[model samples]
Target: MSNIQQLPSRQVSNRGMEGGRRSLCRFLMPLSFPWVLLWVLALGGLVLMPGAVLAEVPNAVPPEGTYEGEHVEQPIEFPHDTHADVNKINCMYCHTYARRSPVAGIPPTSKCMGCHSIIATDKPRIKQLTEYWDKRQPPPWKKVHDVPDFVHFTHEKHLKRFVFDNEGMDVENVAEVCAFCHGEVKKMTVANKVKPLTMGFCRRCHEANDGPFDCWKCHK
Candidate 1:
């Protein structure tokens, strides 16, 4: 009789153990469902996002000083080759005081009239320049090669070092060195940022020249 009673107690304990195991599986099922779902969603996102980004890439660099951004073509196509290359007008002819000032100064209307008044008074560009002058405003010649204002670049220092000759060096003929930073003006029609002026790009050249490799010099 005692053995029979003990057998019923053992069966009850076994049933409780089975019940606990079933409860554990039930608890884990909910947790595992979300974990499996998250992995699937993450993998799907990784596969899809890159194709979308690649499809959105642009052709040319944008204005307002973005290195990799895109731009719509300008309203008026100002061909630099015609004005600077063929005509042999120096860069300082339009952008005067590039050697003296921190700003590569854009010319006022009076400066344009020095040539336009005689060269092509009837041309639309000349007319536009004149109109701006009449209003005491300068043409907003959109800046293509703009470093940010925080970067205090002095044209005076660089020109004094590289351009002005001391004795017989003859200034390295820097007018021909337009391709160094500003790419070939010979081929450009509408102005664009020709170089990627990233930190890595600047460092590579600075390292070559044995120049001061200070981030504060450019980044300020």
Candidate 2:
């Protein structure tokens, strides 16, 4: 009788342990389902569509600058190579303020229409420029190069110091002066930032050219 009772007690305990294990499995299944599904999807994507998965990767590194190496949507697709290199049009012809002021201002729509009105009159891009001119609205030109707000870099000073005073240098065109900082714009279909334009880059150029190194020289 005693042996029989002990056997029954062991059977009940074993059943209780089995029941607890089943409860634990039920509780954990819902919690782990989403993670398991995600891993399965990722693995499936890698096996089935590797190129698509790689192309749509969320954490891919972005290219430097706001406009550099980017196909920026614009009101007009102005070809720099055609204007600056082919036609031999000067950079100052459009950006007139570069000689006198800190900013290299964008040409007004009228200035664009001045040439497009006669040249390339049949082209669709010229037609777009004409429409903007007729409406008297400025083309929403996005700036390619951006300097820090705190740093005060004037185009006038650099022009005076480097281009005019240094007679021995081969800097004849205003475009060459611009090419010192901005890369060869005459060759590009769209202007892009080639230089990193950081403080370190500026300091290295200043030190090489014997420009001012004082903290306030640029920072102010």
Candidate 3:
């Protein structure tokens, strides 16, 4: 009878060991090769998805290349630095047609007199401007950034894409967009063509920004 009781105890211990082994196998089953591989692929997809999304998003990367253009002389030696940088005047405030027209038209004589009629009347440049205003004549402001006649470029479309329609761009920083082709005017008293506005220069920028490549897109 004692032998029989010892046999029952041994059987009970064996059953418990078998149950523990089954529980351990159940816990480790999910970590098997196929399941682990699926998890790894899922994690890799998560890691790479953001990069793909970001690549598709547009950004303001200025064009490259420079040219030493001749110093253009204007009727009144207007200080662009003084108005744009020091006084913090917006470029659009003076060149208002840039947002709606093909060309960024020069500001009228009235626009100049609107401010200089009172402010800084004593300065020599201001005095010169006053003389023009008194004579009721517009200062013959020469164009610094003139593109080829064959090129069908529009300031309105470009500004809309880069400034108004751009997701994160601010209207206050429009000078940066202007600098892409016009150079940094805020630092210069007189505007100069510091960029190589050639076909290659334009093509490189278009390629970089994923712009339209069709010939008629730019050519008339």
Q: Under the 3 Å rule for N, CA and C atoms, how many clashes does model 3 have?
A: 0
TM accuracy, model 2: 0.65
Best by lDDT: 3
Residue-by-residue lDDT tens digits, candidate 3, 54-86: 222248656656678899998877898999889
Error of 1 at 31 (Å): 59
lDDT tens digits, residue span 157-200, model 1: 55554456323324333444334456555456766665555444
Report the CA-based lDDT of candidate 2 relative to the real structure: 0.66
Spell out the clash pairs found in candidate 2.
Answer: none
> Residue 115 deviation, candidate 3, in Å?
0.9
Question: Which parts of model 1 are misplaced by more than 4 Å?
Answer: 1-76, 165-173
lDDT of 3: 0.78
Model 2 / residue 7 / CA error / Å: 84
Candidate 3 regions with alpha-carbon error over 4 angstroms: 1-58
All candidates: TM-score: 0.59, 0.65, 0.72
Model 1, C-alpha of 55: deviation from truth (Å): 38
Q: Please provide, for model 2 over 1-220, each residue's C-alpha lDDT reduced to its tens digit, 9 standing for 90 to 100.
A: 2352233222322344457768966755765778678767877877797322212212112122212345565667778999988888888889888778998889877788787878889998788778878888887877778898998999878777765565554333656667667767777776777655666556556645666767777775
